[model samples]
Target: MREFLVEITTTVPEGTGQEEVDRRRSAEAARAAELAATGNLARLWRPVGELRSIGVWRATDEEELHEKVLGTLPLRPWMTLTVTPLESHPNDPGRLDASR
Candidate 1:
């Protein structure tokens, strides 16, 4: 599996009903929990000084990550996303080894 670092910044656009925002927030949380449970979402963090969230994810490839994961986020319409694919360093102690 390939790992990716995803950053998401969300804005509740002006004039959007509070009720709708609440609903979406609830849905987003539920979906996140589902993804975490499935191991697709490895870790999530809120960065200091930024109105955004960072998530470490694992997927077969970038296409699957985008189509099956990002595309399904309830906040996608209201979010600005940045995705970076992670390459394990050869000298990293925790690096994945195919022979393992």
Candidate 2:
């Protein structure tokens, strides 16, 4: 599997009801859990004072990452995503730990 760094910014549309927003958020959380269980989502974090999230995700390819993984999110329509493909570094701490 290949890994990607994904930054997601959510913008709820004007005039959207709070109830709808809450429902979508609930669904999004459920979908994220599903993705994590399936190994598509690895780690997730939020920047302080920001409505955006940064996460590490895995997929067979970028296409799968977008279409199958992210596309499945309920809040996708309200989100802007920046995805960066990740490559292994020779001196990465995780790699060093694995090699030990």
Candidate 3:
């Protein structure tokens, strides 16, 4: 599996009600938890001083990440996402076969 860094920035369109925003955020959290359980989502973080979040995702490739993961986000319509594929560092403590 390849790892990726995904940044998601969300905005409430002008005139959108707070209730709708709350509902979407709630559903987004639930969906993220489900993805984590299935190993598609590795980690999630909310950055300080920003209306954005970062997630570490594991997938076969970029196409799968887009089609099966990011595309399924509840807030996709309201979010601007940036995805970066990651390569394991030779010194990464979490990598079991770092020598390779």
TM-score of each: 0.89, 0.94, 0.92
> Compared with the true structure, what per-residue lDDT tens digits does model 3 show for residues 13-87?
999899998999899889889999989999989988877899899899999999998889888898888999999
Tell how far residue 66 is off in model 1, in angstroms: 0.9
Candidate 1 lDDT:
0.91
Clashing pairs in 2: none
Clash pairs for candidate 1: none
Per-residue lDDT, model 3, residue 83, is 95
Question: Whole-model lDDT, candidate 2?
Answer: 0.96
Considering every candidate listed, which one attains the maximal lDDT?
Answer: 2
lDDT of 2 by residue, 1-100 (tens): 9999999999999999999999999999999999999999999999999889999999999999999999999999999999999988877878735554
**With candidate 3 superimposed using the best TM-score fit, by how many Å does residue 16's alpha carbon deviate from the native?**
1.1
Worst lDDT run of 10 residues, candidate 3, spans 90-99
Candidate 2, TM-score vs. the true structure? Answer: 0.94
> Please, what are the lDDT tens digits per residue for candidate 1 over residues 1-100?
8899998899999999999999999999999899888889999999888889999998999999999988888998999889999988767887669444
**lDDT of each model, Cα atoms only?**
0.91, 0.96, 0.90
Error of 2 at 11 (Å): 0.2
Comparing candidate 1 with candidate 3, which one achieves the higher TM-score?
3
